[model samples]
Target: MKRAGQQGWSTTEYLAILTGLVVLWRSSQLVLEHLAEHHDEFSWALMIPF
Candidate 1:
């Protein structure tokens, strides 16, 4: 079904969403780099036997 006057996201909303995604990606990159550099201090998750 469709509506004649229905509208989708505006340009500003799209830009805001894109900007948010970029921030999240960059933050994750920084965190991962930090963790990798200090690999000896932090350990990976251990798997327990079922």
Candidate 2:
């Protein structure tokens, strides 16, 4: 649906947004792998304070 003054994203804008999302996804994957490999070190993270 097109709005009166709002326009669709251009090719460059679309590509930039896509690239940003890819970067974030890839970074999260890497962080998750690292955390998994060092799971023991992060055990304290499960502790909750009242």
Which candidate number would show the highest TM-score if scored against the true structure?
2
Error of 2 at 3 (Å): 18
The local lDDT score (0 to 100) that residue 13 gets in candidate 1 is: 76
Q: What tens-digit string does per-residue lDDT give for candidate 2 at 1-50?
A: 77644454565688899999999999999999999999989978888565
Estimate, for each residue in 1-50, the C-alpha lDDT of model 1 and write its tens digit.
55544334465678899999999999999999999998866664434444
| Candidate 1 C-alpha RMSD relative to the actual structure | 5.1
Q: Report the poorest 10 consecutive residues by lDDT, candidate 1.
A: 1-10
Would you list the clashing residue pairs of candidate 2? none
Candidate 2 stretches greater than 4 Å from native: 1-9
Estimated TM-score for each candidate: 0.66, 0.71
Question: Candidate 1: misplaced stretches above 4 Å?
Answer: 1-9, 44-50
Worst window of 10 by summed lDDT in candidate 2? 3-12
